[model samples]
Target: MSDSIRLDKWLWAARFFKTRTLATTAVELGRILQNGQRVKPAHGVKLDDMLQIEHAEQVWEVKVLRVLEVRGSATVAQTMYQETEESAEKRAKAAQDKKYYREPGASVAGRPTKRDRRQLDFTRN
Candidate 1:
């Protein structure tokens, strides 16, 4: 609606984060970057501005298409930014890898084996 919007507000509006507070926290923690640089939550976001956002263990590189301050439906939120091709492909690959190769310990039962404890101790040093 306006010429520009604050980074945190836009991120929330675009559904990158569930709430404005989460968006602000992410920005403060350097999880959001504007034009390849870390920015404050109050930083202005304009059309076509490149952004790198890291959330939920996934990294997104998007180009701002619409600046909005009001949260909207998922479809509308998706239209607010365009994810780069490389980012999409990378996310897809990561998903596939995770699906096929889960962490070795993910299905482990109660106690750690001697070998596991020794391996953990070796890595801790």
Candidate 2:
């Protein structure tokens, strides 16, 4: 494995994403940041660099403890990096808040039905 790794490759190696394509897509969409600045998937990452990754409804701040060019097992990936304590706490608090403040009567999955759409319109009006 190389000492420096591509941002997308590292993300996949770290188990943050299932595949490199997904990580690249996220980076292209400006969802991944390095030291608070947006970076491309091709960006080179070094050990100890801070990464702020935004995925869906959650944000993560992880520090690169190791850099690997090749994908590795879950156990190996676990040793590749570590999330900051503050970031972990923030994530947990945000998750708890989201659970409590979730939209009432909202569908957890899939698109809304016709009836649901009508209800939404009437509620807005």
Candidate 3:
């Protein structure tokens, strides 16, 4: 591995993002923060650097443990960073809450299905 890796590359290698493009987009949109500040996708990621990542309504605070440029298996990628305890707890709590209380609009993905349309029409009548 190299001495340093780009932030977007590191995020992909660490399994935080499925693709480098997504990582770059997230960084550009300020979804990824390095040491409490937003940084460009090309920013260098060093060992032990703190990163706060907000993805899909979940937030993660991880400390870089290894700098890698290549994306690897999930098990290997997991070792690249260490998530803080507080972050883990918060994620768990959020997951639990999501399980119990779902948004009313969560089931709406696209146009209503045939049955849904019928139901809607019946309600309108």
What lDDT score is found at residue 24 in candidate 2? 98
Worst 10 contiguous positions by lDDT, candidate 1: 101-110
Question: Which model, 1 or 2, shows the larger TM-score?
Answer: 1
List RMSD in Å for every model shown: 4.2, 3.0, 3.6
lDDT of 3 by residue, 60-90 (tens): 9999999977887999999999999999999
TM-score of each: 0.84, 0.81, 0.86
Better of 1 and 3 by lDDT: 1
Q: Compared with the true structure, what per-residue lDDT tens digits does model 1 show for residues 1-125?
A: 79889999999999999999999999999999999999999999999999999999799999999988889899999999999999999999999999897665655577879987776566567
Error of 1 at 37 (Å): 0.2
Residue 82 lDDT, candidate 3, scale 0-100: 95
Error of model 3, residue 51, in angstroms: 0.3
- Each candidate's lDDT (Cα)? 0.92, 0.87, 0.91
Name the runs in model 1 displaced over 4 angstroms: 106-125
Clash statistics: count for each candidate? 0, 0, 0
Most TM-score-accurate candidate: 3
> By TM-score, highest first, what's the ranking?
3, 1, 2
